[model samples]
Each structure stands twice: as C-alpha cells, then as structure tokens.
Target: MPPRCQNILLLGGSGLIGRYVAEDLRLRGFTVTAIARRYVASQRTSADDIEMPIMTMTADQLTHLMLDRKIQMVINCLGVLQDGPGMDTMAVHRDFTAKLLAAINAAAQPIQFVHISIPSAADSDHTAFSKTKRDAERLIAEAGIGSTILRPGFVIAPAAYGGSAVVRALAALPVADLPSDLASRQFQPVAVDDIAGTIAWLCEHGDHTHHVWDLMQPEPVTLGAVVDCYRTFYGTDRSTRIRLPGFLLDLGAKLGDATARLGWTPPVRSTAIAELRRGVTGDPAPWIAATGIVPQTLAQMVNRRSATIQDKWFARLFLLKPVIFVSLVLFWIASGFIALFISYDAAAGILSAHHFPTALVGPITVGTSLMDMATGALIALRRTSSIGLIWGILASLGYMFGAAVLTPDLWIEPLGALVKTGPAIILMLAALMTLDNR
Candidate 1:
C-alpha cells in the first residue's frame, strides 16, 4: 500500500537485540541509522552508527533528526528491566514512547514504528517494569500512527545479556539448584533471529498496521526445561540438580535490588524476579499467520550452533562478576581500615623507619588510607567502578614502586605484603576488563 519503507532509524543499537537487528537489516539492503548512548571499542563510529542519548532528546529534536535523516521507519529497541542509576522504568517504557509517538505524528513524511515489547501476562502490572511497558503499548495504539508492536517471549539470542545471561550462568554452574515453584513455571522462548526476521519482513512489505503480535514458539516449556536445554548445549545436562528453598531466591532478589541502586543491573533484581515468577507466555498464532514465520523450537534455537569456548567462559563468569566486585570492595576497605585505625601506629612506623619526616607520617598515613577507602567505595558502585578500578591499579602500582625504593626489604618480608600487591593489581585489571554490562 505505502511506498516501500527505507532509510530506517534504530534506537538502542548497542543492545543485545538492537545490535543483531541493526546488522541484519543492513545485510538485507536497508539504510539503517543505529543510535546508542555509547559504543564499545569494537564498534567504530560512523554515519550508520551514531552515539546519542535518546532519553534526553525532546520530541521536536527527534522529529528534526528523523526528517534530516529522511527516516521512513523507526525501530525502537530501547528498554530497561528495572529502575537504577540513570535507568527509570517509566521514563524509558512510557514517557519515551509518548515522545516518540508525538515525533512520528509531527514528521512531514510518514514513519513506520516498530516497537519491541514484552509478552503480556495476567499480572502485567505486578512490577513497574511490566506496568510501564503496558502503558507504552496503550499509548502506541492510541497514537493514530502506522505502528507494529511486537511482544516477544523469553528471547534466546546467541549473545547473552540480562535474563538470558543469568540463565546461561545457572546452566553452567556445577550444580543446578532452583526453587521448585520457579523451576516449574512456564517460560516460552523466542529466538532473536525470529524477531529480526519479523522486522525484516515488515521492512520488505511496508505493512504498518496498528497490530500487537506475540512472537515466540507455539509450544510451552518450563523454566527448568529451558535451563536444561542450555545445559545440554554446554554438555553438562548430567550434572546434579537440587530444589532450592523459596527464601534463598527471595534473598537473592533483595541483594539484586540493593546492587541495582549502586548502578549495577543484575539479572536477578526484584523486578526481574517478579516478572520471572509471572513467567513468559503469549499466543504466537496470530503473528505466525500474519508473518508466515514458523518459529524455531527451544531445541532448534539452542542447537543451531555448537557452543564456543567464549560462550562457555561467559556463562561461567556471569555469576562470578558479583563475587569479584564484593571481594575487591572488602579487600580495599579492610586494608584502609587496618591502616587508619587498627594498625595506625604500625602503618606510620613503616614510613618512619624508612627515614620519612616525622611531621609527614600521620598526614601521609591518613591521606593514603582515606584514598584506599574512597577507591573501595567507588568500586562498590557500578557507575564509577571502572574509574575505581583504574585508581586502584594506579595506587597499587605506586605502592609497589614506593616500597621498592624505600622499603625494598618489605618485598621479601615474611608476610610478603608487597608481593601480594601484584596479584591484587592483576585482579583489579581483570575487573576493569569485564566492567561493561551491555
């Protein structure tokens, strides 16, 4: 009906779904302009890949950008699972959607809006995440724009992120223990490629009906069965598994909430757990009939390709991230605490014995101890963890060099305190390397 849509604009281009969809669309001969808040080193900046914070932009600005780029289609992949530092559920899922709809209406040329949303459940309003999502869907339906809202079930992508990463980590664990109730809950998964394929189909056909379609496998599967599929892929299906108590899962959710406030987006947050309890389900018959896409089963998705070493490493390290951060936080804070209070005299004595000025000893000891404590605090927060790790590495290096020059004998001390600094520095470097959550 409408002229074949072209010149697309994709939001959240650096995300798990956004990245794959952007690449897929480009390969299919669409002029796609991908936008993200930030890009990794591997993704070079160019006209196609533009880094901009869409949340801060107004509708007028978005309209102007769309007009300037001559965008005929807008695919919004931007979404947040919970509220955290700079991550508001309402702002992202509802307010932004409203602005985007207004922008679409304002544009001189018509634009096809493709929004990626979660599958609806009876208890969709149980959490802020789902509530705002439903709010957005309603806004889109009422916007009077040619739009297609796709509600995808648990997405099984080659690249793991958010909930999928947690699933992989659980499968990779030596023992697979899950709460009995949660283990049996329904979890209908859709392949990421299917979502991409659907979008490509829309792009090719120029169909922008105001229709909300559920994209997932027809058959249902349990949460435990989904994990078992990953376990089978990882060749660990025979591992021992036990049913964990409900309280442990509750505790984990609480911990996840606590970490979220600190700027970390853990997959096990309270909102995430709430949504998980509700489980992922949807009727894909309408979508399949409309798009003529035969969705892949869980086995087909998992066994599409053999697991790689990198995939295994990521799965194993997914859970270890929190452990690494916690250890670093305690390590730095304890070191500072001992130096400042528990062993203040001993800390000052080290410098004094090396002929450090009497007047400078206390100030130096107090200042460095405070610096150590500050570094620990920074590392504890996700927003500043990278900066904190850099500072820690620098401080550790300074300590090593200063000790080598003034307290060389400390290197060979019975405690080997200086020798231990090397490993700590190495650990900090490792944390820095794995800092990015996207």
Candidate 2:
C-alpha cells in the first residue's frame, strides 16, 4: 500500500520520461530502482538529487531480483513502437506489467504499480506491438490491483531515447516542409519532465484511485506551429517535414515492422502516423476533472524541459560520421608505427631469415594483422562497427598468446596485443550474449 516508499522498481529508466520520472521520485525522497539496458543510480546525495536506488537487469535477471528484493512499487514505464525482440513489446509493457502487479499483490503488503500508456489502447489490436499493450491494459485492469495508466500523445522529449526521434530531428532541419492542413491540426505535446513530476504526484495520491490520466498541455496548437517552435528552439528550418499521403503512411508502417525484425531503424509506422493525421484523440478535460492534475502549457513544459539544457554533443555525434572514420584511420596508422618502433629487431630477424611473404606471417603477426585490417574496415562501416570492435578485442587474445608463444613478427606488438585483448574479454562475452540487435 505504501507505493511512495523509498524502494521502487522502474522499467525503462533510460527513456526520456523514465529518466526524469526516476529523478523526480528520488527528489521526493523515494528509493528508486530503475531497470533498463544499463544502470543509472544517482551518486548525488543532495536534497535536490533525490537519489533513486536503481539496478539494471535483463528479463531473466529481473525475475530473480524481484523475488529477492524488498520492492514496494513497480512502475511500467516501458513502451515500444517497433516492439523490439521477445514475445511481445506490449506484453512487456502491459501484460507482463500486470503480472508484476500481481506479484506485488501476492506480497504480504501489495506493491503499487503505475503504468505509462497512450491513447487508442483498446484498439491497439490493429498492430502487433500496441495491441499487446491494449491486451496488457485489460489484463492489468482485470488483475484487481492498485494500478494506474497514464496515456499522453505527441510526447516531445529533449533527448533521443523515444519514438519521437524523427519528429525532433525534423524540427531541426534547415528548411523543413510544413503541410498547410497540418499547420492547423491541433496537438498537445507533453514535456518529459512534466510527465515525471506528474507521475510522482500520482504515486503519492494513489488513494485517489484515479486510474487514467490523458497527459496534455494547455491549449491546442497546430502541428506546423509546433514544428516551428521546436525549430526556433533548435535554430533550424532545413527539415523537409512534409506529411506523407495516407497510402504511403500505411506502407511505411508495414516497412517499420519488417525492418524492425531485421535490426534496422524503420521509417515511422504508417498506422501511428495515420492515426495522428486523422486526429484520433478526444478531450482531456474529463480526466482532469477526475485527477485534478492540470496539464502544463507549452511555455511551462518548455521552460521546465527546454532543448537548450540538453547536451549538444549527443546530436553532434549523430552528425559526425567523418570524425569516426578519421579516428579509425589514425588508429590504423598509429598501430603500424608502434609495431615498427617496438619490434624493429624482430621484424629485421624475420625478414632476413624467411621468405618475403612467409616471414611476414606468424600466428601473432597474421592474427593481429588480420585484426587491424578487419577492425579498420569494420569501423568504417555503420552496421559492423560495434561487432568489429568485439572481434578486434577477441582476435587480439589469439595474437597476444602467439606473441608470447611463437615467433613475434612485427604485427600487433606484445604490449599492444595485451592492451587490445584484455578488456575485450567482457566485450566479446557481451556480443556473444546479444538478444536483439534492434
């Protein structure tokens, strides 16, 4: 019953809203344990910091942690559009979410769960991912636990962790396209931090049994105007942010599903696009009438979570592919020089004694040589870059062992081989243990 306790379990803590929500709870003196691909436990002990005791774990790992930890609240902030790997993203969002609530229910003192959701949940069956959410919502409702679901739309976050990445990117384009009709279509883009603050409010007031909250900002603004505001905030007007036709939108959604399976970023799904274009959301006044949580205005939302406060390097890294290319090349050049400098005698001994190509070849020389070329090329490509790093790290162990074992030709130097090979043990282990690339 004490969902506001110091200890809470949050799913999707890495997301824009999740991060803020976790932070907000910590600010309110709650001990937060957020689960994502990684851990983000707060190190700050300041009164403003609100340290959330977070823990990162995989699905199987989570089950174990839940069984052992003194978890009082489980917040399902995990929502997905493409429904990355596993049985269903929505089930993880909604049904498994309910299951978590049920586990809390079975506790001597039940756990309180707060779910973040979106509109059209009942009709979510039209798509595989969201439909799972729709079903999960129903299951959670049936579970008869103390739970709440908050559905919001056009959720504009200051960072790159959510489905609105393309929308935010489009807003920054130098000359973005704006449809005349879309320029007038109303939207209530909710701010990330506002949602976080509101969630903390709901957790404290769970006694209200106010199950649903349609998060909306005050006053509806046209979509173009929204883009324009974001563009102004970002100081860009280059985005050709034109609206796609209905047919093309549907096609894109299919492509998103297909590409999602292949571990590629798919175009925005036409189904969601079409739904937004069609203006499917209704008034939020009734929900406000129920929970008394007035939505913040665009000005307020922006003031609290302005893009200016976001780290610019995050976006710059996305734009600078050439920098990465140059670094890889430089690394290759440096490796060659370092080998020549450290193993000049070994190089001369082999070259003088053995045949031209044969002397250049030894397990250490060949294996490490292969690593340099492979890693260089791999880093050059977008798809294989991460995998390439893993290979480069693992391949070095073979080379380093040979450097200490067989003839030490002038490929990767003994010290260099050890440097490259050591820490990669974990990297290689992580690669081999991948679940879904997407």
Candidate 3:
C-alpha cells in the first residue's frame, strides 16, 4: 500500500467522530468519501453521500458501492450509546457491520478496514452495546481483510455533542447527584482530533493487516474530575456532590430505560450507567508507537476549547429551554380552560352590553372559547407549535381589539384583565422564537 491511501470511504460520517475523521483525512489531501443513512452537511463530495439505510442494503449493493467508488480504505465510525424505537445498536453495530465485512471479502479489490471498537468490549458481560461491538470486531477479524480495530476511550472535541453533550449537562448541574461508587472510577478521555489524526496516519503508514490500538491519553482521570473539568470550563459554581446509593442509581437507570420508549435518549440509561460504572480507560502505547502522536491531556484539551459567554449560557439553559417550553404549554392550556369555563357568562354579558345580541353571545363565547382551547392544544404539540403560537398571538390581538372597541372600560379595570393579553402575546412570541425545527 502507498503512504497515502488514494481513495477512502467513511461510514457513519454524519456522526461526530466520523465528521472529524473525514475532515482530518481531507485536510491531509486524501480522496475521501462519507456515507451515512442521514444527510451530513460536512460531507462535501457528491459521490460520497449515499442517504440510504445501511442495514437494509444487500451485500452485493455494498460491494458494488465500494468497488465502483474505488475505495482502497474503509473506516467504520458507527456506534450508538442507547437503543431506541428506530435505533437498534445491535443491528447497526453487529449485523450491518457483518454485512459490510462480507461485502468487503467478496469484493475484487482488497479494502483496508478500520473498525471503531469500545475498550473492554471483550470483558463486558452486560449491555448489548458492548457485546455487539465485540461481535462486529470478531466479524471484521474473520473476514480476512486488512483491518485496524481502534478501541478509544472517552472521545472529546472542541464542542461536545451526543454522549459528550450529556456529560457536559451533568457537569453543569447546580448540584451533582452521583452514584457513590463512581467517584473513584477513572477514564482516559482522548481528544477527538488525536483519534482522527491517528486514523489518517494509520491509513498511510500501517504495515499490519490486523491491529488493535487503544486510542487515549495515558493519564487516568477520575469520572468526577472529568465532570469538574467541564464545570470549571463553563465557570459554573463548584458543584456540591451528593452521592446516592447504588439501588437508587439503578432505579434512575430503570426509569431512563422506560423513558427511552417515548423516543427520548436520557443520558442515565441502564446501559450507559453500566458503562460509566465500568469506566473508560485504555493503554496508549500501541497508538503512540504506531502514529507517533502524543495525545493531549484533559486540561490541554479544555484550554484549547475554553467555554465562551454564549457557551456557558447555552450549557446553563440546556434544561431551562425544555422547562420553559413545557411551562408555556401549561400556561396556554390553563388559560384557555379558565377562560372557557369560568369567564363564559361574564364574557357573554360583556358582549351583550356592547350590543353583541344575547343569542349570539352564547355562540360567540363557545366559538372563541373553543379557539382558545384549540390554540393551546396546537401549541402543546411539537408539530403544530409554530402555527399554535401564531394563532395565539392573533387570538390575543383580536381579543384586545374587541375589548378596546366594545368594552374599553375593561382595559383599565382594577384587575387589568384585558391588559394581561399583552404579556401573554409576548410570552407566545418568545416561545415561537425558540421553536426547535430539528
């Protein structure tokens, strides 16, 4: 093989690790292609973006894609922390990988396969995540292809996402609720850049067909220390750690497992907790000896990616955003219910006093009341939130206009009932501005 692989294919290029890997390889002037089920904005090559389900694709289709693309090196950067409704870790990590390896074996040209495997995968008895990863590693080894299995520890980048996002969130909490057993658990968190650079170097200079490198910094830092690093970076108050019993921690994980069913990937899932409890650390000799790259320490990594004012605010407001979202939903629903049931007769009488006929008063009251409830319902749903917010704003404006024209006295009423619409409108607008389309 040449010093620089001519054509490289990156699977799971949409993911954080894969994105970094692709960029690193591209910067080194290698011809790189990235393929994933979802569209990744970073993938620039038109030929690389194959937006199709990997698991569903047949062996022949995959083999054709690899050979047709003239991919000499294949990097598998796929893994899932938690399994949910649409995400099956076993299927992707194990089954899909098996299919890919089989395709590689059948291909006319030999492809150098790079597999991302978890540390301690061989020893891990719990969690399907670890087991499936180990199973994938076995398949890759048995496929008789040139393969490099990278067992990296906690991979961190300049900006955190996915599992790292969860770590930052936990670290930013005002008070840390940790399992008592976890304080001493240490991890050799590796910089993502190191992982990417090392992989690139391996593609160029590697001599062995099969190798397992532990990609991480040699220094072992405790789990609590990792959290503290983030907390310090964000300038959050030094967290007062409260340790919970093992049983309580287990219960929380169980709850997280249940919540995953609702399409929410809670950070504290049973598998995640199990992995954390086990800790993530690996030997650094193999990677350093092969790649000739010294890994950055946690402090070094943190210094390079110092948190800005916006980053700090974002970290603090992570949970606050959802809280505010839910609060707005409740506010609209409660306001609608109160207006519909309690203020009906009073509103009807007010309309009548303004010469809205008595018979029409009841009909108009029901109609407006139903509209209020409808707006609330719409706002409460993720799909129709923007529409609901607009409706709410319009409804509030309409109510205020009607009051000003018909019952002007209510604007200056002692309770300021009519005046409340102004604040309600402002709140609705605020909620609309923060609407998450993604």
Candidate 4:
C-alpha cells in the first residue's frame, strides 16, 4: 500500500462515496484534493484536515489542473443516469473514463487512476450500459494507464447520500417496486461507508496493473425482503408491489443501454436499472472471489430507527412546492406585463385591439399551458421529450413579434413573454423527468 495514499485527487469528491472516501483518506494521513463540478467555497468537510483545495472545473479544466497541481492519485467517482444526450451510458461508463485515463497519463507526475464501475458490466452485449462500461474498460486498458476499476453493487448511504431526501421519499411512498418472486432473487446491498472503506483499502495498497474489483455485500436478499427492511425501519406504509415482467424490463434495460450509447440520459441509467433487476436474479460469487474483502450486508449498514416527516425541516414547508410554483407563475405574469410595455403591446395593437391583448399574452399563456402538455406527452410515449420541449420553448417565445415592434423595456422584461428562462428550462426538465426510461 505504499504506507498510505499521501496525495489523492478525487474527481467526484462532492458525491456520496467521494465525501466519505475523502474523509477516510484524510483520517489515514493522506493529503486529498477533492475535485467536483459543484465545489463551493463555503462547503467544508472533516476530510479537509490537510487543508487541500476542492478544485471545481469542467472535464477539460481538470486536465490542466492535474498537471499544474501535481496530483498523485486520480479517483474518478463521476456518475450519471440519463441526465443529457451525451451523458448517457456510453459517456458515463466509457467516454468519461477514457478522458480521465488520458489526462492522468498526460500529467507531470505519474498519476494512478481509480474508477467506480458496476458488476456484470463488461459484456459487450450485456445491455447498453454494460457495453459502454466495457468500452470504457477497454479504452483504459488500451491506454496502458495505471488504473483500478471498482464495480460495486447498490450502495446504501441514507445519512451520507442525503439521509434527508432519500428518507423522506421512501417514507412517503407505498407499494415500492420489487422483482416478481423477489423473495427468491439474491442481492448484496453494501453501505456507502463500506465502499469508502474499500477505497481506503485500495489507495493504501497502491496495487497497480489494470484491475477490476466487484465491491459487494456478504449476504443477498430479495427485493421484497429489502422492502420489508425499509418498512420495518421507517414504519413506512407498505407499498403496492408491482414487478415488471423480466422480458419487458430486460427490453427496457437494453433500450436504455442503447440510448445511453447514443448519448441520451436523464432517464434512469440502463446499468443501474439492470443492477436493480440483477439484484433480484444474479449471483455474486465471481465478485466475492475477486475482492477478498467481505462486504457488509444490507442489515449491517441501514439505520432503521423510527422517524417522522418533521425530521426534515424543509418538508415542514409542505407549501414550498406550491409556493415555488405560484412564484413561478407570478414571475411570468410580471414578466409578461413588462414585455407588454416594451414590445408585445405594440404588436398586439397591430394585430387588432382584441387580437393584441390575447395574442400578446398568447405566448405566455401557451408557454405555461405547454409545460403540462409536454410533461404528459413525454411520459405517455418514448423519446418524444425533445420535440415536446422544442414546442414548449417556441410557445414560450410567442412575444417575439410584439417585442420586436414594441421596443422592449430592458429594465422590466427584456422580451415580451420572456423574462427569466429558468422556468421554461425547468418545464423542459419536467418533460425530461417524465421519461422514466427504466
């Protein structure tokens, strides 16, 4: 283990595993620099005992930072599940890994790379996600970089991962999804803490030679059993159990995998979905043999103490969602009037007094209306989110004609029906969210 991981660079240090691992490394006398896309100056963790900077930058920016900073170990904890066109399976599992390996090799100090992958993801045709993950592995091997890939099963970190968000969501939901006859399917859910332990183990070992580790739990359980544990923990209402047919889910897994390879995401990552399916089907023997480390079972890791909604201070404002929505609408209303003063009002007069007011507000109204429609349309069908979002954005821009004629009042609303683009963007996000490509 080279005594200890003295200087480590964490790519996804802001994430669940990243935070824990960074903390553990610092505790072990390692100097750690956590790299994240969302690094905040105000955010601090016990892991920073060594006073290492949390460098925030894009993928390209990271290449420069690595050389300039003289980083030793490059740990890529980057992960994604259908967040964008290029961020799909292929990108997350393969392309991103390839880039990291490339940059690490180019660094002034010889960099050792560590990556988090999933099990049964090496098969070229296992699923879209597996294929791309395998692609990433192949690329890393081809580059001949000093790297280690750890493919772990579902990591349960209630407290670290957002004990708040996950607990609240799980608390409210009933009839959680499970595999059919899950009572028999095997699973090995490990804790985020254990995963952090494993990272520490790997860093201390400093074993080089392109390798893969399947970080899994000692015992396996069925989906129903996992749900039972959750039920016992939160006293959460028993959820209606619905299991998708294996073939259907398998098909979805394959489709999702394909979409990811083509750079489509924001839906569930095909790999994770596949893992959920395997959680109820596959064996972890090969994984067990590869990593001598015995993983903790689901029971060993979860803190099932009783709790209530009151625990989450934010939920108390049960009114926040509604208030945010109302504020959003009012924002549009005010922005619309501002638009009226600048451009749309003149265009409306040109359209005819009756047409002017209605038409001027046409884009604003249509834009708001389209938000719901696009969300539904995407949920009802497959891969229609792009079209729905395009139409919605066009609808939101109905004031173009008016703004051009009226001369927009930049102080109020720069455009007729448009003031801030976040809502329109968020509305499109709603449509994207509706596609549960699981």
Candidate 5:
C-alpha cells in the first residue's frame, strides 16, 4: 500500500514532547521519521527510526533527508527555554524554521507543517526566546503552507527539562521559597501526552481549518497552587512555604543569567522570572472546539504519574549537578597547588621509601602536579569540559592503580583517603554525562 499524506517527520523527536508525540503517532499506524540533535541506539523502534546529530547538517542535507523519507507532513516540536554556548534563540526558532519551510517548499510535492509554539504577546514579549518564536510563527504564515500552530501553557512531562525541571526541583525542596508578588500569578499546566495525542489526532483527521490553537486547561491555577499540587502528589504537602521578596527573586535571576553566560544552562533566568511574574494562561476554547478533547488540569496530571525513586533523585539533584561539577574542578585544581607547596625533601623521602630514586622524585612529582592542574583548568572551561572530564577519569583511575601497585599500604591507611578516589571517579562520570551543554 502507498503511504498517505500523513507520513510525519518529527523534529526534536528525542525531546520530552517530541518523543511522546512520535510514539503516539506511530502507535496510531502513521509512518514517522524523527530527527533530533542526539539519540541513543536503543531508542529505535520498528515503527520509526531516530536519526540524530542532525543539527550540523546543511540545508541541502536536511532537504535530502526529508525527501528521501517521503515526509508529507512536518511537525516541529523543537523548543529551548534559555540560550547558551552553541544555542541561539533567533537561530533555532526563527532562522531554522524559515530554512526548513523553504526546504519543504522546494520539494517536489507540497507538504503540511505543524509548529508547537508557546503563548507570547509579540509586542510585549521582551525575551529573545519568545520574540524568535513569534517571528517563526509569522514566517510560517507568510510561507502559505497548510499549517497548524499549537501554543501550549506549562507543558507537564515526566522528563525534567527546562521549566519542568525547575518546577520539580522547587516542589521537592523542603521549603517552597516563592516570590511574594507571584502568589496571584496564574498558570494552566497541561500534560505532554495529552498534547501529543491531540496533535496526532489532528494529523489523522486533517483538521487544518484551525490555524492556531491554544492547548491549555479549561481553568487557570496559581503558580503556588501548581507547586502545591506537585508537593501533595509527591507526599510533601506539609512542607513549609516561605514567600521571598521581589528583590531576592531579582538577585536570583541575575545569578542565573550569569551562569548561562558561563555556558551552564540553569532553568531560573531573568526571562523565566519575567514570564513567571507576568503569569501564563491561554484560552482553551479553540482547542476544545476543534479537538473535543478536554485537557487535564495540573493537579490531575500530577496524579496520573506515580512518583518513582529516579524521579525523586532527579528532582532533588537537577540543580545541584552544576554546583558539584564546579566544586570538583576547584578541588582538583587546588589539590595540585597544595601538592606543589610540600617540601622537596619530604616528597623525596616518601618516594625513596617506595623505591623511587631521590633524583627522579622532583621531575615526576612536578610533572604530575602540573598535569593535574591543567586537567582541572580544561574541565572548568566550557569549550573543553568534555575532554577534561575524560582526563579527570583517567587521572583518578591512574592514581588508584599506581597507589595500589607502588604503595599498597595507602589503601588501608588510617586516614583511608585513597579509598575516596572511587567516589571522585563517579563524580567525574556524572559531570561527563551532563557535559553537553549545547
């Protein structure tokens, strides 16, 4: 049988929303080709193939991929809350959208397009993230392609990414520290699976009459209430609540902005703070009229998913990962300097006892210390962080092996300091896992 017009190509398919949408569409018997920046080999399924690391592909390469797959419709689910390092708000949301649309237009047959955007006022949206999204919408409309734009509010997902990570982290905190002025700020969080199902249904039904739909819950809930719902579901309803003043919130936003400049993408930023202060709630009339699917409320969405150990760990450690990484870098660097300060005679005596020549001790100790410091500096740098992490892991393992072979007594020493190397290596691995800030 020949493929239908709904042969879907999903961009950002490895992301929280895109993953669910692609899988949902596939289960409904639609041919899906998902493109993402990165994907694991195991994520591939019989119904779909996930092609990844496509961010660096040229426009011609992208066009070829689309054409080769016989993609009749494209669903762009790409989104990022903050820009960092290789990420640019304008490039991702505006330039890329324009280029993709142009590629689709250049194809032999016309293709339908669906864009997953967020609610934002064009004139009042000061953040680059929002402005670029608005620009992308305008470009889509001007292209005159058969398109549907979906603007959703507070998309709730099991994965901790962007705003969802922040919400989970804050809700997991022992005390909820909220901005005093934000008490009245409203939101209508919707489940990601629900949005994905709606998009899939629209694709199958060919409901292109509604150009734009605000996918949100029927009733609005306050920001505090959203957090409260999470807390209650997570069994933390009795947690203390403290309202922070406006000034403290501003200070935090500034710090978050500073971290972003350093190539670490923290969820709390000036733009996010600004958006939260203004609040986000969209009218659900259009979505309901077209789809006839009632969106789940924030509370109901929270109850649908049972909390797991992994979720709890992720919620608590999401923000602390960067802090721990930075601390590890500093410790590695400081240890090198401290070793250098040790007296030459004292170092020689220890090496002499371990059968190292007195003359060779000086060069070996100095070289190793220098290498340690260099590795730490490289790891601290954003550009070379990945390499640095590999270096750190090797260095840690080398130290342990050398100590065991040369001075086995150190392992069982009274201080047991050498045993701590295991944890240090684990920490390095953790940092390496999240080193890809782009």
Candidate 6:
C-alpha cells in the first residue's frame, strides 16, 4: 500500500463531478483545496476555494501552488466537451495535462495523481475532443507518476449540466423523439456518488499500482431506455414518442455550433451529437472488483428520490432557455431595424411632436435605435450578456420615464408598445439569471 495522504488539491471544483467530489472528500476527513475559474453562489462550500484561470497557468505556477499548499494528492476534474470561443480541445485536454504532469514531476514530495477521463471506443479518436483526451491519457502514462485514470460513463449527478441538461430537457418536453439509430445506441450510466465513493476508497486504501478503470453499471442500457427512465421520473412516459427526423437534429447541432462561436456552450453541438452517437459503454468489472462498489442501475438512480417542483421547473426551463434568448435577440434587433430604416420618419415625428427639438429629432431617433441594436448584439454574445440585459432594462425604464414625462398620452396609446416592454424586461432578467451553464 502507498502512503496515506490527507492534503489533496482538486481542479475544476465548480464542475458537476468536481463539486460533488470536493464535498464528498471533505466529509471523508481530507483537507481539499478546490481550484475553479468561478463558483456558483448557491454551490459554494466550506472548502478552501481558489478562483483562477487554470488553462493559462504555467507548470512553474502550478508547482509553486502545490508546494505552497503542501498538496500530497491531486484530483483533476477539468475538461471541455467541444471547441468554441475561449475553449480549445487540445489546449485543455493535452497541453494542460502536459503542464500538470510537469508540475507533478517537479514537486518536492511524491504526489498521487487521479485523473477523470472518458470511456474508450473503436472510433474514440474521430473527433478533436476525444482525440485530445486520448493524447492526455498517453502523456499521463508516460509521466511515470503514481497515477490512476478513471473513465466514467454517462455520469448521473443530481445537478444537471451539458449533456445531462440536454437529456433532462428532452425528457421533459413532449417533442423529443430521437432518431432510431441514435436512440438505440448503448449508454451505460454511473451515479456521481459512486465516483466520489471510489475516490474516497482510493484515498483510504492507497493502491500502488498505476491503474486505469472504467466506472459504470454492470447492466447494459440503450439511450432510449435512459431517456425513458428520466421521462418516468418526470411522469412524462405516457406521452407519445414521435420519431424526430435526423435532419432536424443536424440543423439543431449547426445552430448550437454557431452559438458556441458566440461564447455560449449549448449542449446540442456537433461534437456532443458525435459523441452521443458513439454511445457510452465500457467494462466496469475491473472498477467494481477493485473498489468493491456496486454501481447504481438506471432505475435505482432515478427512483432514489422523488422529483421536486424545482426539478420539474429546471427541466422545462432548460428547453425554453434557447427560445427565450432567441426571442429577446429578435425583439431588440427588429425593433431597432424598424426604427432606423422602416419607420425613420415616424420615429423622428414622435420626438418632434414631443416638443421643440427640430435639430435633435433625427439624431436622437438614430442614436437610440443604434443603442437598441447594440444592446441586442451584446446580449447575443455570452461574454457580454449580463451587461446587455442591464442595458436593456435601463433603456426600457428610460423610455417609460421619458414617455410619462414628455407625452403621458403616449402611455395610453392603443398599441400599448410601452406596456409590452415590461414583459420584455422581465424576460431579459430571466435570461440573465439562467446564463451560467456550469
């Protein structure tokens, strides 16, 4: 047995698996320092949390961090599903792994390394996401450190994100019949607690042999079955399962990919579809035997607890999120376009009628329209979405106040355009609240 270590460093602590593992390890009496780029306010724990850009950090910096913290173990949960703005598969999976390995090699004391990886398949290297992950695995093996690589299949955590969020949304919606080919693909799921339990077991009984294990349930299940399980959980199993066309799925993926370039990490992207088609399956016998853990079945996982009102709300809102954002974008941009080009004279006439601004009417109309368009553009990009939402709310309030003061009669207009802005502002607030994917 290897030396038992208590001080552990955990990476990607804000992620689904990382957050659970961090809390679990701390409960098991280990001193865990969690490093994440950002932490959700609701998800924040009592553990020592460090917010930093892990991707940009160098090996020297990581070494110093480990040394400073007196880390005796490292659990890496950091990873990306697809390439997008500020997200590169090679940089995250390969380059980061290489740097992390270098830091481990340079550590003054021996540090146990535990890495979370994906299940392997015949065409695993088909996509850049999978290819880079495989490259990282090779680097870890070559580093010659005391390491263990765990490949978990379709992790079923209480908290939903990424592919899991997509799955929940599909189960909640009535129009979620998948293509037969994709639906029939094998999908093996493992409970998130099982993963944390395995890590805890490793820490308690240190295994000297560098091992790679596939962590999943023993029984086989299809993608369709997994969806059915979730649907059952949501009491939507009685709904008809109309066959969804492949073309629609393709179109959705293209849209997802387009949004990814704008900094949104939509779960229905091309890479996600490609990986889903590949399916999640592996031999979990080794992991079961090694850790003495009996993985939870799909039924067991879903039926573990009753679904709450919040769970149902989340599932329904997950599907409605894209619709809300798209509608907001169109509403803002279209309003601006009409004011700038289609209704330029009418827009100027409003300001002119408001009283005495013969020289400023055109400029005010044009400037406000431009500002409206700019707000929409900012909201469309994930990075500036919050600022855009705030700008939109403020602009709407300004318009309301201006109309009430200058042309109070306009507030009682038959169209009630001003009245509708209230709901639009509320929608923007909703979008801002649900913006964070992690």
Could you estimate the TM-score for every candidate?
Answer: 0.95, 0.63, 0.81, 0.59, 0.85, 0.96
- Tens digits of lDDT, candidate 5, 1-438: 433456888998877788778888887788888888766554566446666665566677778888888888889988777677777888889898988888877775767788999874566688888889999999988887788888888888766677777778778888656775786788878888778877776666554333887888879888888878877767777877676688877887887887677666677788888888777777889788877888887777888867888878877877787787778888788878777775545655667789897678889888877888888888877767888889888988998999999999889978787899898889889888866432
For this target, which candidate reaches the highest TM-score against the unseen true structure? Answer: 6
Residue by residue across 1-438, what tens digits does model 3's lDDT show? 455567888888777788778877877788788878776354555565566677688989989988888888889888887688777898889998988888888886768889888886477547888888888888887877788999888888865565576677767777655565785788889888888888878777765488888988898988778878888887764656666578876887896687566555556688888898898977989779877899999988776766787667656655555456566667777766776788767777778878877778888877877787787778766657788889889988998998888789989989998888798788787777655412
Query: Candidate 2 versus the native: TM-score?
Result: 0.63
- lDDT per residue for candidate 1 within 122-233, as digits (tens), equals 4556888889999899999998888999999999988888889999999988775778888898989999999999998888774656988999999999998999899999
Leading candidate by lDDT: 1
lDDT of each: 0.89, 0.58, 0.78, 0.56, 0.79, 0.89
The total of clashing pairs for model 3 equals: 0
Badly placed stretches (over 4 Å) of model 2 are: 1-6, 40-70, 84-87, 178-186, 208-210, 237-259, 262-282, 303-384, 387-438
Q: Model 2 over residues 163-227: C-alpha lDDT tens digits?
A: 35554555655543544554566777776665776667666765524276667775677666666
**Model 4 lDDT, full chain set:** 0.56
User: Which portions of model 1 show Cα errors greater than 4 Å?
Assistant: 1-3
What RMSD does each model have against the real structure?
1.9, 9.4, 4.0, 10.1, 3.5, 1.8
Q: Show model 3 residue runs off by greater than 4 Å.
A: 1-3, 40-50, 173-179, 237-268, 332-438
Off by over 4 Å in 4: 40-64, 83-88, 108-110, 124-127, 159-172, 175-185, 237-275, 280-292, 304-438
* Cα misplacement distance, residue 185 of candidate 1 (Å): 0.9
Q: Write the per-residue lDDT of candidate 4 for residues 1-438, one digit (tens) a residue.
A: 355456777766666777677777777787788766554444466443223222323456667877666677778777764444434566666766766765676564567788876665343245665567667767877777667777766567644232223323333455435447433456556667667776776666656678776676656666556656655555554546555455655565565555454434313344555445544223455545655566667766654444455444332232133233334344444554444555554644444543446544657544534454443343223355456455545654544445445545532653533455546667555544433221
Which pairs clash (backbone N, Cα, C closer than 3 Å) in model 1? none
Give me candidate 1's TM-score against the actual structure. 0.95
